[model samples]
Target: MNQQYEEKLLNLIDRMVETASDDELFAGGYLRGHISLSAANCEMCGKTSVDAMNNAVENSLKETQSELNPADQLIVNAMWEKLRQEAYNK
Candidate 1:
């Protein structure tokens, strides 16, 4: 995994968490951990930034319950979907 890409992903997620609404507890916590783990796990995986971030987000989402608000879910899902498509295209 590319260090710069990992940092990019973390920056995006950090921004997301910072701007999350009060009810987005799951999202904030999940993003925080995902950023940390992504930076750690993909430090040398040889994957592109998109792949690493998508994998990190999906993996984190999988581990937690999905009790999310529709709006929050919509935002997070959209972000992930866009990144997923970008990763596949790369």
Candidate 2:
């Protein structure tokens, strides 16, 4: 289940490469790392739920929140939410 969710998240990001604006592209790329890492962590910890994966990603983002400026942070946050919703709906 975690792997499926991770793939959905990654597919959403991958689909953005062709038409995403510069900011969206940047946000997607930035989020890919967090999502991938969180998924791996979930796997290592034997966590299979999508919620666990999402929480791990959220925590990872908070941990590195200082890396982005306020505007960039907003962009990434918005993109993350969008991706999460889209992935969940699929």
User: What is each predicted model's overall lDDT from 0 to 1?
Assistant: 0.58, 0.96
- In terms of lDDT, the poorest run of 10 residues in model 1 is 81-90
Position 49, candidate 1: lDDT: 65
- What is the per-residue lDDT of model 2 for residues 7-29, given as tens digits with 9 covering 90 to 100? 99999999989999999999999
Candidate 1: regions farther than 4 A off: 13-20, 24-26, 66-90
Alpha-carbon RMSD, candidate 1: 4.9
lDDT of 1 by residue, 1-90 (tens): 455554554555456566756645455454556656765666656555655666776777656527566677766665656544543544
Look at candidate 2 and give me any clashing residue pairs: none
Q: Candidate 1 local accuracy as lDDT? A: 0.58
The residue pairs found clashing in candidate 1 are: 1-46
TM-score: model 1 vs. ground truth: 0.48
